[model samples]
Target: MQVVPARRGRAVRLARGQAIRIVNTHGSQVVDTWAFNADDPSEFMSMEHLHASLGSVFPKTGDALYTNRRRPILTLEEDTSPGRHDTVIAACDVHRYRSLGCTEYHDNCTDNLHAALAMIGFPRTETPSPLNLWMNIPVGPDGQITWGEPLSKPGDHVLLRAMIDCVVVMSTCPQDMIPINGANCLPVEVHYEVTG
Candidate 1:
């Protein structure tokens, strides 16, 4: 298992048939995840497409995560949590922090994604909506959403298998201003490993 340090990110390469096990090591961290086709960075995982394909805002085990071009990119083969992962919220960025009253620079998932990909020599400029692992954004009957605390316990994991060769990026979201990470508003590290 590899550690995605608190408020940081990591990137990994995956071939078709391989799977990545993302562990909620701390139980409270929200790992913003994204995937892009290995041969074409422009083609990436799309949350909108996934919502349409799944016919629901929440993805569960055995669900195929789709891409912008309406093709399967990753499959959620397993999940060991309460199944409250979020699909509606956008990845937190500098603008988001500014709106939250931050005056100085803030660490965000957007920057983390770019930095992580660049580290792997797979630079990408677009910031697509991520599959927020363990995030809890409850939708009310009136269609309103509320930022809720994570429902996963420590050691919970989600296994995602690649449908094609791709680059997967994960950011341990650094949103200390909100309780999205948890009720304590703390950001922490998580672990992940690739398996055949």
Candidate 2:
């Protein structure tokens, strides 16, 4: 595993067969994420469609992922690494910070994804939806949920093979919260290996 840096405001592209394993070197490191069809830049992801496409819930093993137009995007073909991943946790934005906590985290994944969206010229204004792949945030039986601790370990990661050429953008969460972003700033690693 490589602990590389995803500098703030930068975008990344992961080709087919190449999967990204976002590591929470410490724990509770929040990672806001997004995916798009590389061939069709205008075509992007919609959490609504994704959740519905997977049968009105966050994707699980063997779930069928579709694009904005309901075209096949990816299948949860494998999740052998991490024990859990949050599909509903929303990436915090400047507004959220001002209202919920701090405005300092405004330049995090949400902003980065928005910059990326504008750069790609994708018509998205409803706020960029990011999938928290490794951060530990869960809902309890009493309907009370807590976003704390770490879900995956040092080597635990998620592998995603693109059904089509796609753009993957991530924000190495800089939110230095005890329950989110690990309370300590650190780096992450990304790798791609050809399979198909």
Candidate 3:
């Protein structure tokens, strides 16, 4: 198991047929996740395309996560949560923090993504809307969305299998302005491991 330290990010390269199991070590940490083709950075996983391909905003186990080119890049092979992963919320960034009234520099998922990729010697690419693992954004009947706490318990995990060779980035979202991580509004580390 590898630790994605609190308010930080990690990246791993997975070949086709391999899977990564991301564990919610503390139960409330929301991991903003993204995947890009190893051979083509422009072909990264896309939330808009995934919503259209799945005909829903929520992805569950057995779902094929699509990329910008409308092709499967990863598969949601296993989920131990309540199937509440979010596909609509954009990853938190400095701009978002500013909007939330932060005047100082804030750590965010957007920067984390770029840094993680760079650690692997990959050039920075456009930030795609991430698959927010364990993020609880409840959509009401009135078409309103409310930020909710995670329904997952400690040790809950989501296993994503790469359909093609790709680099998967995981960010331990640093959104302390909101209670999306938990009622305490604290961001924490999570863990993951690559599996055959």
Residue 84 of model 1 has an lDDT of 91
Can you tell me which runs of candidate 3 are displaced by over 4 Å? none
Scanning candidate 1 in windows of ten residues, the lowest lDDT window is 118-127
In TM-score terms, candidate 1 sits at 0.99
Candidate 3: residue 156 lDDT (0-100):
96
The residue-level lDDT of candidate 1 at 15 comes to 99
lDDT of 1: 0.95
Q: For every model shown, what is its TM-score relative to the native structure?
A: 0.99, 0.72, 0.99
Ranking by lDDT: 3, 1, 2
lDDT for model 3: 0.96
Which 10-residue span in candidate 3 carries the lowest summed lDDT? 115-124
Candidate 2 stretches greater than 4 Å from native: 1-10, 14-28, 56-58, 101-105, 115-126, 141-143, 183-196
Backbone clashes in candidate 1 total: 0
